[model samples]
Target: MAQTTDLDLVHVIKRFGSHTAVNDVSFSVAPGEFFSILGPSGCGKTTLMRMIAGFEDPTSGDIRIRGKSMIGVPANKRPVNMVFQSLALFPMMSVGENVAYGLTSRGVSRAEAEERAGRMLERVGLKGFGNRRVTALSGGQRQRVAIARCLVLEPTLVLLDEPLGALDLKLREHMKIELKQLQATFNTTFAYITHDQSEALVMSDRIAVMNQGRFEQVGSPRELYHHPATPFVASFVGETNKWQGEAAGAAPDGTVAIRLPSGTMVKGQGRVADRATLAFVRPEAIALAQDSSSLGGLPNRFEGRVSAVLFDGANSSLLIDAAGFDEPVRAVLPQAGPLAGIQVGAPIHVGWTVEAMKVFAA
Candidate 1:
């Protein structure tokens, strides 16, 4: 990997009158690493990206590339390029012209610009589409063209703002693999923004989960998956079951016990406090059984009637209605091997391993 240098942000804040779009948020990116800032529509991920690209100036704080500060640098003067969500490709221009736009703006000659443009197109899997009109290209081709234009500049860093949000599911999946490979081949730092958690998990070396202009957690995919730092992350990362309870005793082995209103004590692993409010358990961790729930060995267990069953190829998603644990406790059963005679309307017990239970305060 060709590392450029570290990119740093210090107390970066963006405000619009009294509303702060981006609070005092800060994070860093390692050169040549794929880092993603993920959150919902108004979470300020895109706002931070624009500020870094110089399209918008931070109201306060500072941003640095390598070791040089970039407080007031103009967009074009920065050693960075961005592929906008709308792509911003010129409609009147041809495919080759669109790719060579950056080069021409930088004073490259027409002949050299055209040649380099063709090569860049080829690099992004659009080899011979150069002579065609930009309008003639497909959505995926347009995306590649946008990427090629940015890459042609060979900047120290690249900002991709939801580049794959426009493509279909199958194309989006394929492009995810291609985009990761493309970044490695270019060996440039990539600071991408997306609202899709699955996309962030699949593409990034590290993910920063943001909420309301603040980062809720930052870690690698597996770390965020198995050990979410917040309730928002645990519920948002993937499908999870949540319960409201209060701490009842001391957990010697790091397993906190939360007592429900019905006197049911659900013991599991989490940071427990005297007034703990929430418990999180991933659906995949919960299992359905006909025998005893083994609640003593499990952190949480509930007896319920099967409400629904959905067979999704490799796994079957089960929904059970249980007392004290409302909202339909769910579980995943193996597809190749069903859980033997389990059906809707059958009485069953739902259980989860102690380690599978995640407790969070509030």
Candidate 2:
């Protein structure tokens, strides 16, 4: 049986003076699932998050948690906790004190709150560091302390507003796994916000990719990567190479065709067309074949030349100038195998399967 989804946002909309920030958006998150809202700046991700966190009231529509409405409720009363990018830990207080702040305010006795705080600190990998001031802790540690503080209350859901934004690349990457682990450990529903696609892909069970106040697409990391719903999603989620083509035709079996500029027709079977559609492809989907490059009437078969070859240790990227495409197409191949001999100006045959291509009309 399918698991019931939690955290429903039904037609949620938020508007500021003379501007609509979140426009009639809707999606649900499953219970205990790590979900992320991803988009560029000014795309309304943060504004939507604020509404969910009860910081900003929605101009219209329903915001539900476990099926109850959260329309007029304030942030403090919501069954959710949020950790901000700022790490908002009280600098003057010890780590223990910071973690106990919520409990102490809620009428818990000092000794009891402090003891619970200590346990939470340990849970976040800060056991013996409780006495240290927040200012003395490193960026990552401060982040953990801030999370420990909010999570000590054991909110059913935790909202993270770019909590790893201040960390370095390596630490940001490290914290992604740590955050996932913490979520699993606590079995908490986490609503995360980020502009970083990699971060969303790494952490989320499902992702809602926002664009200009609406969700452009929502799916698992693999779904979004392998089958983007729109051109915006294909470009935003990862590296993609585009080829402009008009809808030549579609196969009776459901594969679609796009006639490229070079008068060659590349067919891929994944479009339910409503208008002039565009073919979306991933660079890594293109294969470098050892045998002859010909798939008779196969979907997504194309011929191109290696315009450039840039080698990374683990993988190499080949910029191929495919027939029917004006710009160079990028293809990823193994660094130290049959693809190693591929050089700039060398004739190379690259192709992707129909399943690897995503088509979008708009």
Candidate 3:
């Protein structure tokens, strides 16, 4: 069975004079799915969102919602709602009034609007607080109110533009879970855009990694993390140690050997076409060995002196100055192991398998 597409963009291109913001991008969102566009600033993610919301017209291509064209539709006429980073909840109105604003504007009876607002508040876990002033609510409560305000209108798609960007670190972490729960509870299609990889990975069913003015890759969090399609996607989606090198040639086992500028030979699994290649090994993929023998039969091995210990609780890592490499190699240390107490200037062995190294043509 083919699942209904809630939103579809066909070769969408948005250009400003000579500069193109979004260049021939196309994708679709399944009904009730939580999709996210993740990228750095000025990556055209927000511009794409604005186009979908009808605020800006695309220079080319088409946008459809529920199989209906949205090319000529106005912002207010679209069956979509946008929740901004600021939330934009009305401080002057009571929580109930704020949530009912859209319904009341559409000629719904005041009593009916209030009744629906109350139910919506309950659904968002703010039960019995409709009559309270918006100023009295906490940050997370205010976010829920903003969402309720949009949901009250029964929009087919909800666009959240970095809705958690304004919250503190702890609150943002807490709200990520709450936001996913709310989205699941409603079973509504959510198109989220954010620069935070953690937020996108934690909440999205699938993520579109955007760079410059286009999507570099789109996949589930695990797929993007484990098998990034491009060098940008590999470097942007997570923490990794990247080294630039030239392709030395392919080995019998199909692993391509790369000769780094530092004259270090490292082998990785990938198609090596371009002579200029970039290799990425995730911090967690490199294992620290007490001795050369501890590396077993790993293909790539190096000895280095510990330069620094980055302590982040269970996420502690080590910065090692490996011989023949100008840059330090970062490797994750086990939370509790014999190497946990490794100190600066201590000599250590680090090694990784060819499969753990992702090689891409630069």
TM-score of 2: 0.92
Question: In model 2, which runs have C-alpha deviations exceeding 4 angstroms?
Answer: 1-6, 272-275, 290-303
Residues 1-362 of candidate 2 have per-residue lDDT tens digits of 64476689999888889899999999988889999999999999999989999999999999998888999999999988999998888878998999999999999999999999999989989999989988888888888898899899988779999999989998998999998898888888999999999899999999999999999999999998887877898889988887667777777777777777677777665665664666777888777664444544345555777888787765668888777677888888666666687767777767777767676674
TM-score of each: 0.93, 0.92, 0.98
lDDT of 1 by residue, 41-111 (tens): 99888889999999899999999998788998898899998988789999999999998999999999999
- What digit string (tens of lDDT, one per residue) describes model 3 on residues 1-362? 56489999999999999999999999999999999999999999999999999999999999999999999999999999999999988888999999999999999999999999999999999999998999999999999999999998999999999999989999999999999999999999999999999999999999999988899999999999999999999999989999999999987776999999989999998887889999999999998988999998998999999999999888889999998778999999777778889899999999999999999898
Model 1 segments beyond 4 Å from truth?
1-4, 293-299, 340-342
Best by TM-score, which number? 3
TM-score-best of 1 and 2: 1
Residue range with the least summed lDDT across 10 consecutive positions in model 3: 333-342
- Could you tell which candidate, 2 or 3, scores higher by lDDT? 3
Instruction: Name the Cα RMSD for model 3.
Output: 1.3
lDDT of each: 0.85, 0.84, 0.94
